[model samples]
Target: MTTPSERAARGREARKRVPRSSHGRWIPSAQRPDPLVVLEREAQDRLPELVPLRYGRMAVSAFAFLRGSAAVMAADLAAQRHTGLTVQLCGDAHLLNFGVYASPERTLLFDVNDFDETLPGPFEWDVKRLAASVAVAAFQNGSTKAKAHRAALVATESYRTTMRSLAKLGELDVWYQRIAADDLLPLVRGDERARVADRIARARRRTSLQAFNKLTETDASGARRIVEDPPLLERIPDIDRVTLGKIFSDYRSSLPEERRLLLDRYRYVDAARKVVGVGSVGTRCFVLLLEGRDDGDPLMLQIKEAGRSVLEPYLPATAYDHQGRRVVCGQRLTQAASDIFLGWMTGPEQRHFYWRQLRDMKGSAEVETMSPDTLRTYARLCGRALARAHARSGDRIAIAGYLGTSDVFDRAVADFSLAYAGQNADDYAALGAAIAAGMVTAAPGA
Candidate 1:
């Protein structure tokens, strides 16, 4: 049998054959133009196009707009790659993307929960997105630049150090150990330690049963149901609903025999239209209520519309043809444990989407409500988690070799973050201009 180290070496060697390039060149930082300048132009082009989609709904707050603005920034960041190696990335890995969800083992694990835009790209693209998010989040919370810089620096340092450490570990070890709520206290500082402990205690109270109770209700006929309201939420149109019903019936054929058996035990109860997340609001989404042998026993599944990955056209070349499949596969590769029911299905309309439990003991730390010290601690935690996720898919040794022991990369990220935050301000101004010019309908408050 192969030793674990030998197995890791083989895995690493396999990765070496995978193409790693950015726009066909290895441009270093000094040679690259300011990423912020590129971001501004992309935002000017894309953000105006999205405004008409907002309609009469309350203009999503500035913070919410920033989340959607990632596509613009992603385009710019991809154009300015300083490093040659890139890995599948969580395109908008902000502080909020780090959250608590149950692993397959039923343990509450903290990790990156969204993967809609995940794809292979320059590693620093992720780091830059994360850093700018920290700045935006801190600014929204009234944090001073100095304090925010301190937090950003801490986050970048944690990422650099954690990636280096993972580089030395056996591949399986790196893959198996994920950060848990139980690990927070040791890394927290001062009064924030007690606050983090309190938060974890609160998070622990939210179990699957608690989630079921909060989201499900029984109708007058005593059938378990998910209620819906129109515009914000509604039943999916009958034509599409019928088509999806047929597609889901065929979905069983794609699953393994054992998985098909498990799914066979439940029947689809109802499907309701739902809107979700800051960036995903306009996309088609639905919640499927599944009934087992008993009427009261329910399982809720969310089927979201998946589009082409924002990174696909930019990627050099790869074996995976479907961008949605690439996302699901990448998520499985990076997450220590994922939802057991996680799977993908395609519709007659040719759209692709991945499905999973709607809410299985899912919760997030309220960063806006957190104290500064706690925010700093949480930043470090998110940084470490991001590093671990990257290590699972990238060349850890080469990354570690590039990062070294010094704080150069950390400091560089901090600098980029400060500069990028300024760029976000400029983009936000341009968005305001588009709204003022009647080029697009602005949401109520926006």
Candidate 2:
């Protein structure tokens, strides 16, 4: 058996052997399939599997499902991976998924906030998804195609530059340093700088206590309660509810003794169903309200449905044996700071993801509403964050070498974005056709 050092060396050599694409090569549009058709097929497959977890008021529209269809898009795109060793990807590293959240240390940090589809795969798969998202967002905001193209180019170039820089840094330096919200203010245009500052300040005020307040309330009996509504939110099934209640106890037992002791101080006050996010619709998600000492002292925890990563089945060799564990492990690996309560459990009812302090000072720039300069600033920041994430899991030197100090990769991504955005539009159209043909029932306002 090879020693660990030898194994690492072999991995590095394999990465070095991967070929790089030449600049100015023409990749025809016809070579790509319609994105909507791909999306519809995925939606159809997932819809049946989602039956057990469809909470009331959840987003069931074709559009809602399409938002969560990154897995489908990823599989299609991975089939076209041309060059570069596939690194573990954020799978859904779109602009919107990049946002601000409090670290375990209570410092507000900006980084990728979602990783349901994360897996080891081609690096350009991420670049292409991000670029396509930029184009779609710009188009939605009524920006001209040229503006969208420019924004994509700037973002890709930032990724290239940052990856190269990180490749030269020591591991400790790369891991300890991150681009914070404050670091982005100066990069914005003069007119938008004030708004960005104000946003950051507002974000700073968000805390765990504040999140508890927003998501919880007291009933007539003065017991803590989680607010709920139909289709959007409802009580979990009795079987699932009972199973989850027992699992929470097991989860507490699984924590470090100190944390378990801290958790014992709180009483389970109430549980209610909640629907969250455009892409995460139809997944079993619940909010548990816990009370400590008095009714006034509250804690909120979310148990989200964790499923197999979309990238797993496609890239079978690199896929984790357990999808839920992959999510927990991937989140910890990629985020600079993660939730202390972050953990996973598999029960007979379903696999559940446990996390704490939802909506704590969480804020994202409205990329759709951004002016050109603000968009540039946001793009660069996300690019840097993406590079930082990739560096953590792969050999940065080889990636940097593949990128070099040139516009070749930038221009290639920009060209790919233009081509792929058209693909997404076509996919969106196919979803519309499926809805029109009565093939699938779409949720309202999806």
- Where is model 2 more than 4 Å wrong at Cα? 1-66, 82-86, 237-245, 253-258, 317-319
lDDT tens per residue, model 2, 73-132? 666665663445556689898887898877767777888878878787767677767776
State the TM-score for model 1. 0.83
Give the CA lDDT, 0 to 100, for residue 152 in model 2: 82
Top candidate (lDDT): 1
Query: Candidate 1, which segments miss by more than 4 Å at Cα?
Result: 1-62, 189-212, 237-245, 253-256
Residue range 98-195, candidate 1, lDDT tens digits: 88878767788888888887887767677777877787677768888887777777888888899889888887888787988677679877777787
After TM-score superposition, what is the CA distance of residue 164 in candidate 1 from its true location, in Å? 0.9
By summed lDDT, which 10 consecutive residues of candidate 2 come out lowest?
54-63
Lowest-lDDT window of 10 residues in candidate 1? 18-27
